[model samples]
Target chain A: MTNLTLALDAMGGDHGPHITVPATLQALRLSSFLHIILVGNEAEITPYLSQIETSVRSRIEILHTTEVVSMSDRPVHALRNRKQSSMRLAIELVRDGKADACLSAGNTGALMAMSKVLLKTLPGIDRPALVSCLPAVNKTPVYLLDLGANVSCCSETLFQFAVMGSVLCEAVDKNPSPKVALLNVGIEEIKGNDQVQQAGQLLQQSPQLNYVGFIEGNDLFSGNVDVIVCDGFVGNITLKTSEGIARLLVHQLEKGLQQGFFVRLMAKLIAPRINSVLNQMNPDHYNGASLIGLRGIVVKSHGSADESAYLQAINLAVTEAQRRLPQMIEERLESILLDINS
Target chain B: MTNLTLALDAMGGDHGPHITVPATLQALRLSSFLHIILVGNEAEITPYLSQIETSVRSRIEILHTTEVVSMSDRPVHALRNRKQSSMRLAIELVRDGKADACLSAGNTGALMAMSKVLLKTLPGIDRPALVSCLPAVNKTPVYLLDLGANVSCCSETLFQFAVMGSVLCEAVDKNPSPKVALLNVGIEEIKGNDQVQQAGQLLQQSPQLNYVGFIEGNDLFSGNVDVIVCDGFVGNITLKTSEGIARLLVHQLEKGLQQGFFVRLMAKLIAPRINSVLNQMNPDHYNGASLIGLRGIVVKSHGSADESAYLQAINLAVTEAQRRLPQMIEERLESILLDINS
Candidate 1:
């Protein structure tokens, strides 16, 4: 029941509104005052809207558009060329302040390209980096920045990401001066190339962070630290890899349970326990990643998101906007970029 | 008994000989022909060997080496200084033709560094890569090269890895022309950097390779391709992240199965099934990464390897030696490098 209204990409995602619509209803049931802006062709969202008409019928607002950003759409061409696309228009609502944030279960590259140009990176913010909220041993998530936004990064950009990631932890998890680590081959001080090595030193020097030394890829989920900083290329691979492996493990478990009647019975007996375990490790629990240091909030869902994933994103956006993290980051890092310029 | 003996670094790995010893014994029990050249101090190995006074023990040679390479030891410094070190001595066996291949569950950096300087990269190979055999949906591992060897890579190096990986796949799996893929963030033909894009073009243009187009991180386990190529930095991150997430998955599963008496009973009933599933996805199965395209056979195991992991390394080295993969790769890629160089 917050003041923020979220634009949900209704026609987007692999499952479209089937999962998205149901997940939306679930979020509405959880919230008292969330005004939803459903952005897709009216005909497509109308049926699902009618289905969830009880809890959200009065609170919801529809922003109809016909253009669909296919998974394989040319990113730059899609944003510029597909002018009236749902993904683009939905983001425009955020730009126009008609909605606080735009959540999409659509093509990632398109969303990033569109959001960056629309919401724009905040002052002194190099780019709108994608942060990944990874489930850690603690109830809190491990915030990893630049998860495939800027593939190529300099030492300074990575350093900036560390700062942004730390601030994000503060905003979302109520952690101030969150522990930060640069992704590297080794945990030692002298590990990695000039970029990561220099970034390591810079994060350490930046008093705004609780800079721990380099963390390897294996340390990401080990509850070793709070924030992990990396270039988009490495981050993307890490995020997708973790997700894919988790999926594989589940698949392997299912395959095991199907081998015999004994295993099937065992699975049935422990189904509740298994469900609780999955609930804890569920990707949805740590779903939304805020585009930290953006002039405005932009939360990207998994390109294959169901309604649950989109709902997580909306909550993330609302949280980020409430914190006003962009202003804080600008205030802190303004001197560095300007000092370099001067 | 097998005609070939393999040198094993007894002091290496997290679980030491407890796991390593059992795993080695497992491999020995399975393989009627493995003569393990136990490389460690006489005092350290004598007790273990004395317990195994079978006929096979007579064939086992205990090489009493004075020095053991600490995981923290500088690679080049250790190789140049510690001539009597276990890892160094292990490689020396391959150099002196005492063992067909050498496997070590010691410091990875030390192994690779020592291996490269001692064993040397194949002619035209700029650097030797630590290629991990990634478990795919196809039930076989896809060879991923440069998994944290040389971080920054040029086009020539990636192309060389593609050749080296293909050769390894052929020799190890007996697949003549393995599907080669360059790991990029996207799946388009022109999706990556100048280096990857150029390599992708070259891979396509080359008649020798079964060159597939670019693959994203998700495709690694998708069974869409056989070999994945990348710079060491990205490869290392991918490998480590995959392991980290896999470990998390096991922990979650174990915790969930132990929630209550009912759950525990179910878990006990399904213990055999779970173990079978775990055995299939066991990291030990893909334990050893051959420093492919090197002049001599050098296998690198994880620094924290268990007995099963070490044993797997021993088995891998034996198989590579049996197939003469290094020799085959040298013959195949040597001319290609020369072609590129010329």
Candidate 2:
């Protein structure tokens, strides 16, 4: 908790201000040194701000804009048309050094598009990737990257993703020299496609990286690796598939728990613990996915995220901003590239 | 069980005859008319066969093969050498019309290669794909295909998978005109890569096939469609990822259930119900995957499957054999291709 000011897209996400406004107030209350600038339509966002007390309200600032990026809007359209949109303005604040970070629960493609253009990618990085932490068995979260930023990636792009993922993991998790792994169909050398195989070669040659060999999808939560990298197509599907499984299991278990009178009654007694377990299993609970490799911090919340999940996104932004993640990545990449060249 | 004989590669999986033999006996007990030809080393196979009673023992036969395919062996290696391997011989039984179907829990690559070469793909089909039923919210399972059979599939290859998946789903699940979908990163038209988009176009044009549009990974268990198709790479990762999540949730819940005395006592009271729910969630319990598009039936069990899981695989092979899946696919594809050509 270092003192920092962050920008929030209050007009983004499914519920927009309904979820983001409350989450913003909650964040301000929790962090005494933190300040947030809410970007959205003035009339829609002002009502949520009215309930806050004067002392706490002093830390909140609202930058009014009329336009908003809908979920269905194409990335290219959003970039060209929506200059005053809440999502765009939030990232612009970070780009202009008016805020330390940008957090948005908006169209993922649009958010990435705006963030990359405005905040710009860090030097030596070709593109920014979406990185998210997934719950793992060993109490620590596993960082998975390129969650649908670039659908199909080349070998060099995948290599860049690994470098960004490793830097972000080390900076945020406070684990130096974090073990990185490439996600593939099998653990064997000849398992994945050409892109994955070529990337593996690049990683293996980099002595600067703690590059473990291949990891399959089943080991996503095995807690044996710190960072797992793949192209966006596979990564997106893997993340979403895990979410679907979580929902299915929870729904099935709850249905089964309601069967007999005694079992139902017993279920009530352990409802709290069961709910906690379900929450941990739910990927929605881990809401923030950083658009890494950009010059400034940008955290993307799930489009359907509720107030609590939105709050987690804000907290993630705070953490990343405080740690100066972009700077660390810049320094790390510079040295790694130099070493490879030598 | 319509008095069908299945060739079993008893020496294939991690446990070899130890798990497969007990599973075969269990399958025999469940289906009185079903007979199994256990193909493996005579010395190792005879010991398990000796313990069975006289009446049930009549249903079992041993086909000795000393060479067994190791899990690490490549597909080309197994196809070139290891001709007398249990996996190869089991598939040969189906090719020679000695058995109705072939089932193995052996090295997947070897099994597919051997099955494709010996049994051969259907007339219009270029290759065989691995199709497995995944647990959905509805009682009926969803069929997902191309599970690591061909790593990176082309548009035409993906189209073939959809046709094969539809045929198998209709025959095995007994649902006529099953809703077929292509698995993609998004449901939108502009979402996936070239192969997926082109496949979508082909599926849309096929009026004979019940081709529903795209499905995202989160909808895998939604039970909205009967058949979901993807390349081997994505399908394999999705299947294994869900399995990993199931284990994580079950482990987390069990750990939670063991906490307090009162809650622990109640957990024991409902332990049976809880176990049943966990079993349904676990993918291994739904253990059989069909190697479809071949001229003969072939079912694949998990490599580390236990007795119960392996038994499910045997049951699956029996069902496919009884339904004459390959014949159904051949007839269906003939008419569909004729319709498309016209």
Candidate 3:
């Protein structure tokens, strides 16, 4: 197979090129059939480019741009003024067929806006949903969608998210028929608002998807469903709350271990085991979030992600590029439309 | 001060009289000026009543009824058929002014429904939100409301929740002017749905509330705000997600500690510290959920709560009863309404 190219927004996030460049090099070392185009200012990229090993420098390219998107820039403002920004240029590479996929740790709203306007949504997709894989109790990853893309979604939009989320699990996780569930306050059909109830009905009626009815927030880690769908408002709150609770527990555990001499000595003795558990619960391990339903693949990494975390984002983009995710979603959507029409 | 009386639905929870009776006895021992009316089947309450010490038995009285509300019963069904149920009768005690407050471990939906119909809402309050206190990093409990009452709330309804939640912290937590925040996906005013954005504006405009603008789910435990107000769907999901993640981390920690011989031995040595941390994070310690914004005080305990947890619920009820919470909220609401009218 030929090497897949990924466009990295090197001038994005807090540390910008300093973090992205090193993460790209690390990803390149691990994956032989991978190439990265670092997009940022020429001066900033040159220093990082020089640090890469001469032997492996051939696989690393630089796409220099003068403009940059600030963290506080609004979506509308960024779209209007950041035409030549590094984030925009990286996304443009995918639109112009120069790169297989685009990965950014920049402003999420701006990235989504630029990606939508540049690559456009798939043929049958009205809006792109922010989807991500979360670690679950079943030792498998569960796909949750509309994290913060469309805060208030209608029934049709939610149904579209479910379809896209299901396809993501099937294409990426090899789950032929992923069970999709709607996140609600209760499992009963009578629960939630009109939008969720209508969406649940549509999901149940869909012949192509495995709809498993309604589920609550606790079900996210229950490992009972493959795809959990909800409006962006609820989805974002659930995701962030899970992240916050995870951090709180780790902080409390460390505090507990530092109480006295006896506990401190015991903590040192079992440090390796405790560290392993913490590593598995680390949010950095699951850094990348997929901007699904777009014309081309785009993965958003956390702004504070370190080397390993950023590398995971690049690897996620590579995997999606190799799977031809956009084409697969388009095909699936076309068949569903045909089924409804017929 | 006069002894405050509380109505206890002894047959409500999973363990029935087994957990409720013991919990009531413990609460009686703790509060000398507290009286409880245990409502349940006579046959089931008699054996537990006999087990109680003769001295404390005077403060614990039984109100026997044959009907009971099951956990699986729907709210509408429980309201329509279980009219004479122990849960309903307990709420009736409060309605008739025989008991200062009511504490039940029955179905949440049923409890809310019956309480709404029996106790009704305070004047100027459109809807009664489900309010509860969550442990925060500041070692103080932050009051959050609309847990699962009104699923789809408009802008005005959200503002009402802010008012109710703020008053809850003031009356319960004794914060003179609590800082109130609207739970949103982002801190920016332009973020979240139309409802949340409009609610933020309304909350900011209200001179009665010390509105602190928008807060995300991560801020729930940050202990930065005194009260967090959100629609029922988002609030319920956030609370449950936090609970789920807490359980997941504890499970992971225990599993990690038991893996090796050295780690297991070390775990035993530091078990006391670990237990203390776990106990602080235990949901059982914060078991009671207050049904705020009603004309009377009604506390809902988890159906699966054990003896200690049930005792906490009874104690919470006792505290609220002595505080005259309903009258305090009424006065605050009336003053706010006067401010609006004047």
Candidate 4:
């Protein structure tokens, strides 16, 4: 495979350069054909870069910037004043064809706004959605889109999300024909608001897409469908709620183990097996959420991501870059629009 | 406490009388002042009743009904054709003042339809909402409403839900001036749809309610707020998704335990502790969901609830009945409406 270059937002997330620099180096070690352009203030990033080995240092370069976008900065404010910020500069690299993709763990709203204004949406796409893969019982991850991009979506926008999500699974996950379902309260035809119901109708009519009708939040991890589509409002809530429940379970299990001597001894014996399962279910295991539907690739890592989790985000950028995901989505969307117009 | 009579739809749920009968008897054993009028096919219910001890037989009565509401029956169809159905008869008893409260594990749509038509909504309520309590990490249960009643809700409807939910926690859960919050994609004022944003504004302006602004889905189980309000569409999806995640965690943990001989042995040793923790997190532990905003009390159990879970539903009904929940909601709503108008 040819080397894919990524623009790393070094001054992003909570720990910024401290987390991003090591994660970038670790990702470079894993993939021989990978390069990154670290974009951040030189003073903050240089100290971390100096720790890298001399041989690997050639594969990395720093694009110094003066401004930083704090977590609390508003998207509009960031766009107007922080044009030279690390987050914007990294996305600018993608727009300039200097990088295969860009990755950030910065303010999600600002990152999305900067990416959209700089790279622009692809043809036939209404809005770019935050797409992420959630692990399912079937051991194959299900792709969920519009995590928190567009809070209020029209029927046409949701229909577009389903198409984009399907393309994502097909391109990155390598599913030949991904099964897509609209997330609703119930599976019945008469369920949900007009936006969701109308979207389901449009999906069913599309011959190119494998539309599986409606699915509830409970069906998210059941792994029955490859792509689950919903507006950002419902998608964001569902994703966060799932993470909360997972944490509750682990907390309860640990509390249970601390009850008695026999239980503690037994828990110690099976600790390895239990830890493996917990790690798999950990939200960190699936940290990166792609900002799909844009002309250029932009993957958003969690703001609180550690080095390992940040590396997972880099891996996502690498995989999507290698597969030429944005180009594939553009092609699929054009054919879909042609099919609809015909 | 004065004896509270409960009209139970024994024919409701998948297992019908098999689960409801034993659950009723168990509930009777726990509460000396509790009385149940079983509404279902006499033949099926009589067999289970005959097993009850002669001493407690006086507390139980059979109100035989020939018709039944199947899970697949449409709400409109059930209301038109099945007036004499077990589900309807149980609700009718509440309307006729023969029972203090009614409980049904039947078709959710049918139960809501019949209850609304029979009991009617409270004077100021626009619509009746399905309210249920969810277990939180703090070991306190948070009351959530509109679980699947009003699919599309206006800001006023959601504002009413907050009022009704607060009254519920106060009356049944004994939370004085419960902290109420609107469930949204994010806690920020600028986030979420117009309806949620408008509802938040309304909530903040109201002095009668302890409105705590917006909360995300992750906060549902965080135990930070006493009442979480949202439209039925979002609420139902969030509730079901939490149940699904809890189930997935248990399934994965068990699978991990079965990996090797040593692990299996260790799992066996810690089985009791694990089971205790799982039971607490089980949906069964929190099975009862009350239909709030109505003039009369109506509780809906899970359609697949077993005897133990059904008992939880019965417990909810008894508690609400003893506390005079309907009366409390009516009074609180009146004062709030007066506050608004003033």
Candidate 5:
């Protein structure tokens, strides 16, 4: 009976419909006002329908699409050839206003390509950015923009990305005055290269952003700034490196503790504290990065994402939909681009 | 009495004499074949002399220099104006054959400028690279070159750097057939722009280098390779960023442990393990990056270095002096530059 419909690309991710169906059911249970639109082959979805309760069945609906896009498939080719891809169909649901947002764990490039091709950029958006949440000091998540969304970037693009990132932090993070920083080599303003230096000056001069000065990678988890801006290439490397190291630390901890009984006892005593630390750093709790500056909603998930990650993605879309995030981005960014154009 | 003499710049770091003097003494104690050359104001050196025992005093010498280069002073300006800076004095000692190699905790730019102007480059050396060791998986260090020795770099420079870095690793890390990787955005030989791709081909075809493959920032710690080669801009950024993050993580851990009873208990139990982890990650433990291809030897510390850090620097210089590392680099890299020119 409610109008908040979310389109899910059920055929995507490692778990596919096997985990997708139940996760979708679990998400729908959280909101009585929620509606679910599943995008994939109807034949594949049909076999799993009997598993869900009759009440949950009414809240879920299917939109049939025949083609599947494998993770390794070329993005441009897949978009050009497969009009019936579940990812495309899911995005179409948002474009046509049948669903509020599309959440996909499909091939990231294809999702981005299709979203750009189908939904188009929001008015005044130079480029759409991928925004993700990172663990900050107090267990709160700060938004980092262009997280592998684009590799090569210009000063103008980064300047604009900063404005868009600030808008999202305000819209979603709810910090009325979101502190913004450009990632740099050092704390000293002049230490970064020409591009970062120029962007720093622009952000500082602009009334649109708080322009919290430069932040090194260390400051990302320090909670000193609410939003961190960088081109996608640097952003991608930072994100993956931190994740890899954190996982490596956890692995080392587990292995090191298992070597002796005394070490194991010590681990057991400290298990809760370690759990708290790990939970504070968990990516799942934060869930879903918004594709900022997109006209309509599209959330990309890790290609190897599981049911828990998809559920997080679904929640992210619903939150953004209810909050009307992109519309706010478009409005906030209008003056900045107009000034540049003029 | 040992003929081996190392010229330590006493007035270099943010902390200056405090860190410098102690580190010199520590180095002298650890290494039997070392004569410490303390370069700074005689007034400053005479006071620290009281701390050294009479027997050790016989091995220590001071080259009186009045002026120290402040961090704010420009590189070329410091080199021209501060005629008595420890960095300049140290380099002079090496050139005059009074010392084997120069070690400093001074301004990096000033040291680079002074070393290039005075010590000059080895024959066929296009550019001298600052190469240092970073953590690899097995708790051993890998050599990463051009770590702020040059800001702007070309394909030929990087190709030459790989050869220099391989020899430096062999001499210092003792890793024969050290796997050299060109740092890039991706592993694809064609992933980066033309310069990186061209260098990739040259490195792969290089018989002198192990030439393992392309490496990203994440791969630096993986121990998959022993020598990482990149432009100075990227290398400098990577080194600083890693150091900044390690410091930030320690701060976070301290806060998490010392604040409450649960945290204190957790800290007490894991204190030994954390110390081991941190000791393995300390910048001081892997201190002293080499300015390779210089006509003589020069080593620069992190600008904010302390006494322990300076001692690490002195220890590194003694190692380089004993190995006669500069002679090895000069002999090894002569033909690599020829290949580039041809």
Candidate 6:
């Protein structure tokens, strides 16, 4: 494996450098073959960098940027004006081939728009999708794609997502033939809107992909399929909705535990086991969402991610970079498109 | 407070007469003014009726219908051909004014189609919507609408849903000036597709509705809004996604509790309290999604609902009947439309 370099957007996310700097340092210690370029204000990032030893610090380089993309900054406005922003600069590093991948816990829309403008989509791919691994019942997690990247998608774009998702799943998960499904309201034929219906038809006829047909929202966690494809509008809602329900249930359980003395005692005894299990299933732990179909790798971490979660995002970027995901997608897509065209 | 009569599809749902009969008896026992017309084959429904005494059985009438709408039956096919089916007959009873409302745990699409064709929409309503109560942090449950009733809803249809949802929430939940929100990918003014964006603008302009702007999927259970409106496609996915996540979490928690001896013992000790708390928040307990905007009240229960859940659906039917939801919507829509037009 070659040495992989990741550009970290140090001034991204709600906690900014406070979370990103520590996560970067932790990531550096974990990966011997990994180098990180911290992109943010020099003074703010320098304080966190000073404590590390000179040899370890040798792998870490600070690429200072004066501007930071605020979470609320509109994507178009940011793209037009904030070129030197840490998020854009980090993506620029990937575009300029200075870094194998870029990691940011930042504004998803801005990052996506900037990455699209700079890195560009691979040949035969109309739009890049934000793909992430979701915890499922099976040992291997399920991949769900286009998570708020494109709010609306036509049939061709959705088809492209299905192909890209399959390639990524097969490469990353090491599954030879990954089963892919389109996310719809119902699993039955003649279900879903025009876009989904047409996409289903396209997926069904694809010889190069293992298309398993439609899956309902309830079946998402069943792990019945390796890749679940949808437009950004639905995918984003599904992801966020899952997070909401998980939080609500956990909150309810904690409240229930506080009511009675014996119950509270029982809860205390079982808390460790429960937390371990829950923390594994927690969406917060699932850190990075890859901006797939792009010419270069760009990993977007949750803007609200903590140090541990941000580190997980950095780890994900390293893994994708090591695997050469974009190249694999580019290779697989050529055959898939040839089959479709034929 | 007049005697409320409901038509139940006895042969509908997974368990058929087994669940419906007991749930019917229990409902009759609880409500002194309630009368039920169990519509199904005489042979199938009579066996259950024989066990009950004459006094309770007097409130129950068996309307023999040889045909039954199977779960997988297509909506249009069932509506066109299975007019004599138990599900269709139950809905027909409401249209004929033989029953005040109808309850079915049969095919949702079939029920919606039949209800729309027979009972018809209110004077000003373009289409009907499926509205259900979802558990939230607040004392009152959140009302989410258009749950797969209209797969693709125009802005006008969405605007109508907002008005209808507000009326239904006010009438049934008894909450004055209920806060309404449109479900979208993001809360920002610029965040959604054309349909949702236009709907938001329409909602914001409506003086009759207490529009609270856009809400993401994660906030569906926040209890901050009384009514959440979306196209049937998005709403159906959101509701099912929540169900899927809830089931996954509960399954994981149970599996976790079964691990070690000490943990298992603690689980047993705290199981009762835990179950009680979980039960209150459980989506299964929240039965009976009302098909609103129609001239009659029709509540669709989960096809897999048990006796208790089935009874909850019947109770919902009685409540909607008592409140006269259609009448309220009709009155409210007239005023709302007047405001919009002026």
TM-score leader? 6
Could you give the DockQ of candidate 2?
0.73
Worst 10 residues of 1 chain B by lDDT: B277-286
Tens-place lDDT per residue, model 5, B140-246, is 67788877778657887888788888888888867878888987766755355456678888887767678978877666678788888876756765666555455
Model 6 TM-score, all chains together = 0.97
Number of the top DockQ candidate = 6
Off by over 4 Å in 1: A7-11, A15-33, A38-68, A135-138, A282-286, A332-342, B10-36, B51-58, B62-64, B135-138, B284-286, B334-342
Instruction: Give the docking tier of candidate 2.
Output: medium
> What is the per-residue lDDT of model 3 for residues B1-342, given as tens digits with 9 covering 90 to 100?
688899999898889999998888888888788888998898998887766676699888888899998877888999999999999999999999999999998888899999999999998888888888764444888888889988989998898888888888887778999999999999986798889999988776678889999988767888889899899999888887777777777778888898878889999989889877876776655788889888999999988899998988887887788788888888988887677668
Per residue, candidate 1 scores C-alpha lDDT tens digits across B230-329 of 9999998888887777766667778778777877887897788887776665554557787887788888777676666676778888888888878898
Kindly provide the TM-score of model 2 when superposed on the true structure, using C-alpha atoms: 0.96
Q: Which ten residues in a row have the lowest lDDT in candidate 3 chain B?
A: B131-140
True contacts kept of 6: 0.89
Q: Name model 5 segments beyond 4 Å from true.
A: A43-47, A282-287, A338-342, B121-127, B135-137, B145-154, B188-195, B216-219, B254-270, B282-286, B335-342
Report how far residue A121 has shifted in candidate 6, in Å: 0.7
User: What local lDDT does model 1 show for residue A256?
Assistant: 71
Superior candidate under DockQ, 1 versus 4: 4
lDDT of 2 at B153: 91
TM-score of each: 0.89, 0.96, 0.96, 0.96, 0.90, 0.97
> Which candidate, 1 or 2, would have the higher DockQ against the true structure?
2
Pull out the clashing pairs in model 3: none
**Best candidate per lDDT, number?**
2
Q: Can you list the residue pairs that collide in candidate 2?
A: none
| lDDT per residue as tens, model 6, A1-342 | 578899999998899889998888888787778889999999998888776876579999989889988878899999999988998999999989999999988888999999999999999998999999875445688999989999989999999999999999888889999999999988888788999999999998898899999999888988789999999998998899888877777777888889878888889988998787667666666788999999999999888999998988888898899899999999999999888889
- In model 4, pairs of residues that clash are none
Model 4, residue B108: displacement in angstroms?
0.9
Question: Candidate 1: DockQ?
Answer: 0.62
Q: lDDT tens digits, residues A202-305, model 3? A: 87778888899998876678888999999999988888877776777778888889988888988998888887887777665678999999999999999999
